[model samples]
Target chain A: MNELVEFISNNLQLLYILILAIFIGVELIKNVPSVLHTPLMSGANALSGVVIVGALLVMLQAKPDDFLSLGLGFVAVILGILNVVGGFVVTDRMLQMFKKKK
Target chain B: MNITLSIIYLITTIAFVIGLKMLGHPQTAKKGNLISGVGMGLAIVATIFLHDFEVPSINYILIGIALLIGSVIGYFIAMKVAMTKMPELVSLFNGFGGGSALLIGLIEFGNFSEDATQTSTIIAAIIIGSITFTGSLIAWAKLNGSMKDIRLPKYNLINNLIILALIAFGAYIVMYDSTNLMLIYLLLFASLVYGVLFVIPIGGADMPVVISLLNSLTGIAAAITGILFGNMVMMVGGILVGSAGLILTFIMCNAMNRSLSNVIFGAFGGGDVAIAAVGKTGGTIKKTTASDSAIMLNYASKVVIVPGYGLAVAQAQHVIHELEELLTKKGVDVSYAIHPVAGRMPGHMNVLLAESNVAYDKLIEMDNINPQFPNTDVVLVVGANDVVNPAAHNDPSSPIYGMPILDVENAKHIIVNKRSMNAGYAGIENELFFNQKTSMLFGDAKSALTELVNELKNM
Candidate 1:
């Protein structure tokens, strides 16, 4: 219980950031029309690949002989790039087809 | 955590917000996607070059190699994939994102920070990431027809028990020992099992909800990873995706008149009874030729086309466009009626039709078009069944009974094109096919539409 309190007290800023961002996110996505749902989904998907930053940090911070962490971070980096690139390219392709009334 | 990296992350966060907002409209969605992609690129470059990791000899070459391989494969697949296979591709990509988060959590565990908050966050990331990874792969396999829906006797009970056990085990590890690799692997294995079981019982008709739900899981996983690292860009971006996916899931469920829990636990559309009471349908099937249908379409004042997954399967979007043009030349009005859950995912039919150059304004949603059906002269249903099924309204015992469907029956004339009398993915009979005003034009969607176009031209 002491540890729980200590953790929350030490990280109150992160907690506030998380809560506020969730509110902003919910509000922003509420207005998207149904026709754009697929692209919206794929685009949001690409953004989740921001975890690649965490992978890079791990790779840089690992000790020279820590092969396991380095190898895992390397694979994570590759997967994150795949998610971001594939998601954005595909979303662009889909969005190009949606022509408004002439 | 340095000032330079912090400023860059803040810029990236703003870009993501504006980009997501721009995605709400058709006019700006493509540009919105490009803006967000630029933000991601900026974040990556800044992280590699400016971040102070303090470790000696960073492997720039290895990182460059990874980027090259991933980018080439991702670009080629996205470029080459047919529009019809989009849902599967999205599922596969989502799985890889989850895989990355899972590995990040595992790597973090190797360094095992003693902070209670970080430990809990790491556990959260690992569990959520593993579930998203396995669950998404299953959804992809099901969408691509590589696997079948497998339902155990009392599968929901089994799923619930596993979930409970996993939570208890996770809590135990967080409190007792956070650095044990064996316990972590056990947790991962159990989460993976739960993920597979959670998706397998859901029939193909409910794939939209499954995909959206998994997409949300990946986002939450990313956010948890961000919490562990205290990275603002990851937090904001992940939360945005998580909420976006949750909203979509709710929207899809509302369109179908089912709750999220019901969709997961109801195990609806088991195809064992595919040919349910065929003899009991009230009306006989009426067959019509393409020439007859074409003549009807040519003479009609206003026609609304209903395209389904079958349209995508037959690669008939282009031919349908041709038919639409020919009808227009004859002074007939043509538009498309789009059901919310029409294809495998939300907005699936729109993407397919758009790829074939269908105009955005002409494809009307269910609520707006349902009321106009009574005044419509001709309703063309191509390779679609469940969305137009009158049984959704009139038959109480039907599995899809309460679902909202396109009111195609109210139109003056209904013409359906299909390859056979087989049921749709939901495995339920469509009473719309047997209605008095309906005429069945049997053949592949592409070939049938082509024949109709040819017959109309010679007239």
Candidate 2:
């Protein structure tokens, strides 16, 4: 817990990046036309699967005797994996359909 | 410590941003998606192999198994699902994303669910994550037509109370020891229930808003988890999800002419069954058959196909493509007139038609196609109603008024294919149905299309 606090205090730069990322996200998405909203939704859904990072970190730090933490880590890992893999594949499948008014 | 790893993470972030940027254009979207996928692949690889890059433990076998199994399942599902079921597929995937984040938050709070500083973000993750997970499931079911709209006694009161309770309890947990593991897990459970209740009252037409809202909720969950993990890439990805989902949600709301807060809190629009009895309804309906409709198409010089959720429901995109091809062969100017919110999700109709190998050149937007309808010899409206309704333009008291709709009414002749004359998702009367220029062909869309194809052959 102390390490968590120390890391947070030390990593104030990352926090600023997170906030900056939000503004960039708002601007980036405005360019997406409404017709592609489903794919955008799907793509964003897959994007959130980035939580696989936190799940991995939790598992790595778990004590050998700690079963509950380990179990949660396993659930997190499997679900996270499914999310990213499934989301990207499905979104690509949908995106393959878009064409112009030729 | 590992400068190389940081560089790779930066590359991954650039991949994501650039991928999304290119996704805005139809010409470059597929390549953009592949770029983003590469970024994700890069992130996963760097995480697994690098020691100082993350925490200590490494189990190649577990990671390998999970990836292999998940990939196979995802591939099969994505490949096998029919175009009509795309909304359901996307909803389930979004649910998994949110559910994973909520579980991560719970795991974080294992030692303490509410420790002043960590409590705020962790709880945020759980509440938003759980809501997204269940809310998406409900929305998916409703879109799939498997679930009916549910309204409990005092639905609004119960919903408001539950939200208030969740907030108050969360604050209380922060103030107390937050030691009880039961309470932590219970919060997830309570929130899930709230999610289900939250979506049950929204009418079918408003489902795009619900689904998009759920997508944004999952994004917020991911963003909070990113902050908790102190990972820059995850944070960037989460922010993207949050903003993209939110933008999509707002677009849906604006198109519907409904306020976002009204859709979320008011739980507006009800009436479980569509106004099913088409014959007794007010306007005089001129009924036609596949053969007669086909004759009309056979003679028409120009035609437009207006598709809606019903087209997706009946998996008729392929047949519509075939019809379009046939019409083009006879020198009919064939192009689709797509309303902004025609299908259950954004770009849903386009994706479906693409699966059928329909030319994108022939698919036209509402703004561009409306003016062409008056000049069009025939407008073949299949499985759509509210978007083509005349009421949107003229009926101020109507629920869906001011909603921009396709100008199918102006076409010289209108041919609508449906199973019956039931009201559309908005659960209001579409005066377009009663228009004297309109002729309703009551039957399953797929079969009607198929029969129409056969009739065209005879011609």
Candidate 3:
């Protein structure tokens, strides 16, 4: 059972490659109308915040022996969290400036 | 360690997707950010509980120190940095992200033996991460005016050769299984140098494209790091970065009427105008006094004010606002015409106008107000130069030819406020100044607006 778990974890490398290939493929065809670019860019920026969630998962799954991984993962999670929060706050502030005046 | 944490992670991912979607519209962008932030906070909290045993005292101390230093510096910089400098600041932040990823890759490589798979991942991360870090730093410097706008000498050939050599060295190290990490370090340094060289030649005007490019590099690096560690977040994050950056790069290229290949490889040699057009026309311009300009404004039934970087430079938004209020009270209809890429960054004019408490309703974008210029009685151009230049409309041989322009010249009377008849960012003479309908009001924008305001009081 322990060997099986280790094997599954080790195969994550393949998953990374697959995902990257898909991303690049999607990007190549992302010639959306120019009007939608701003909204799309903003949406993508917001999505990039997912780094925090991934960082957390890595931290949780890391072995106690791999203290450095655990530590760096935790730090990444924190910063990623701050980025998401701050990004939202700033985005909101900018939007509010454009709100239709009563 | 188990299902609860997984659920939280899943929820965070959903939030990320939603936030990104919300970011597409200006109206819901804030809420999207809020939701994303909530997800991030949850993720952080989930992380703290994941580790089982007690952390060493030193590790805990280090974490605390890092957090404190980071937050304080981050908060201070965000608060102090002007909105005009925000894009450059963002580029700097992206650099930090790339730096972090590169460090992770280096650390991982140090511990892991040179297996085929791990070596490939490490090599990819080293190249991408190092390039992202160095490219972003040069971008930051250029935007902040620390570096010259011109391209560094022999930059293109040197960069290509270095990148090719690094990749070759990387393949060699991977294939040989050499413990000599010196080659890896050399690759990292070459990548870093290549990044700096790539961005230094890109002029300030093309900053938007450079920024997007650096962002994509950061994403690619992060994804490669994920491959090294087999982490889903890094991969997803990198994809997001790379895709978004590519999209933005395309948009910026369209905005400037240049192709991606042209933007990257073509060294933009001239200012806002083509160098060939210089000295082609040397017609004398008509000048007017503050009193005469005041008379034109006072008698006009409809006035359109075009504000630009000069207004911001003179810190004259407030005075302009006051002038607008005076004009409106006198029953002269007034509206402001704003160009899409006016000022340094996108929406720069809107921000400056908003800062001075200009009524949101009166501020009209270029497309909406441009057609109204034909019937306009007076056009008050305040410190605006390039965006209003008539060369864009009439002169085909002009560099900015075919680019859309505000039809300020269509107005029956034109009062242009400027310090002198010097050319704009394009460094070419403005034919609009020499037009028979135009009158140059030579003075500082803030002072001229103030004088106009004072003159209106007596009328």
Candidate 4:
């Protein structure tokens, strides 16, 4: 029973990766209208900042002795967050310039 | 601890989502940034408590010192650096990220033996990290003007051979489990050199594509590092970077009417040759007075303004905005046509225009504005060249042949505001100048635009 559980756990990561690869492939092949590309890309880049969450989780799960990993994870999360936030701010600032005056 | 971690992750993800959404429009980007910042802070706090290692005095001191130095330097650089240099700065930052990943992988490899599980991780990290590090460094050099934009002698064949040899050597070291780490280091060093050589040959005009490519490389490297460390977040983040970089690269390539392969292998350096090819018609160009041009502009029912790198160089955005205001007051419908690949970086013109408080609605992308040119009474080309060149449409043997261009010639009147009839950065003469409908208005962009503004005010 323990062996079966271990096998399943190990395979979970592979399955997740497969799903992600498929999503990326689909996105690439689909013809996104040119007008939407900039907005969509900006959106996607911002969403990519979601890695910070994973970083946070890893840090939280780190054992008491795993200081180096924890510290690195923290730094990653911080930087990732900054990227997401800064990117969004700049994007919005750009888009706002295009908005019709009230 | 698990709950805290989960919450932190959830927050980070939300921030990412919000940030991306905000990026789609300029209005909400600031809020998006704040959301992401909050998420980052949570992640940092969660990381601090993750491991219970007795804090080493020296390590803490080192971290503090590094942070202080980095922050101080970063602050000064950010404050002092011109906005024009932002793209190069971004490339440098990407290099640092790639370097970090490589350093982490090397450290990890030194501490561990190449087991079946570790083999894939180590190889992936080393290859991706090395590529990113070198590629970004080269990009930085190109942007900083440290390297010429043209290809070096026999660069194509030599670069390919070197890359192949390095890959083969790296594979051998990884497969054989040879305790000699020097071989792996050597491979990495070669790759770094190759990256610089590869990017150096690419011209300034291709910097946007280079930036996107390096960004993608950084992502791939980060992901590989994550895999080696069995870090789920790193893996996801890396993949994101790779995908985003690729998408941006594609967009930039499309804008240039060039393929990825062409951008990578094409020897675009012989700009001087292209310039010489322009028929030396000794006939001097007829120059228009600012007052005359302004009178035409003031009376026009509709006008389309096309901007380019020269506008950025002159810092004439404010004057242009004022001109737009004056034109609008005269009941002339005004709009701007923006080429995707204009300026040194992606969305560079937009940033400059926004800084000058130009209305966003007035700014239109190439496709949207291209169709509207026929009905425009006046087409004003401001510091723009290649994008407005008619050779793209008419000339078959032209280097920029088959590339899409703005149909500025279709307008009843075309006013080209440039310093002189010097060929653009691409070293190609704009056939638009020869068009019977076009008139040359020569002077510095800012001064010329300012004079036009003054004339319009008097009119």
TM-score of only chain B in every candidate structure: 0.97, 0.92, 0.88, 0.92
Q: Pick the candidate with the highest TM-score.
A: 1
Query: Which candidate order results from sorting by DockQ in descending order?
Result: 1, 2, 3, 4
Ranking of candidates on TM-score, top first? 1, 2, 4, 3
Clashes of 4: 13
Model 2, residue A23: distance off in Å is 1.9
Residue B132's C-alpha lDDT in candidate 1?
90
**How well docked is model 3, in DockQ terms?**
0.21
Measured with C-alpha atoms, the lDDT of residue B141 in candidate 1 is: 97
lDDT of 1 by residue, A1-102 (tens): 786788789879887888888887788788677788888888888888888888777777877778888788889889989999999999998898885645
Which segments of model 1 are wrong by more than 4 Å? Answer: A1-6, A100-102, B272-279
DockQ leader: 1
Per-residue accuracy of model 2 over B53-79 as CA lDDT, tens digit each: 334344445456666776677778777
The worst-scoring run of ten residues by lDDT in candidate 3 chain A lies at A33-42
Across B1-459, the per-residue lDDT of candidate 1 in tens digits comes to 679988999999999988988888888898899999999999999888887767657566567777888889999999999998988888889998998999999889767658666777888888899999999999999999999999998899999999999999988887886688999899989988988999999999898788888998898998889888878888888988898889888988988999999899988876554556344576698999988998899889999999999999999999998988888888998999999888887898999889888778778999999999999999999998899988888887787888999999999999999999988888887878888899999999999999999999999
Better of 3 and 4 by TM-score: 4
Best by the lDDT measure: 1
Which lDDT value does model 4 have at A64?
48
lDDT of 4 by residue, B1-459 (tens): 356555665566455445434444456545654565465556545544544445545444434443344445544544455555656656665665565555555545655555634654665566666676677778778778787675667889998998788767766766787667787677668877877787877777777687677767766776666666555545654675577568778877887889988888885524554766477323445679999899899989999999888898898989999999999998999999888766776577776787677877788988888889889999989998888877888777676777788888889999999998888877787778877788899988999999999999887
Off by over 4 Å in 4: A1-12, A18-102, B1-3, B52-57, B269-277, B280-284
Q: Give candidate 1's whole-model lDDT.
A: 0.87
Instruction: Judge candidate 2 against the unseen true structure and give its global Cα lDDT, from 0 to 1.
Output: 0.79
TM-scores for the candidates: 0.97, 0.92, 0.82, 0.84
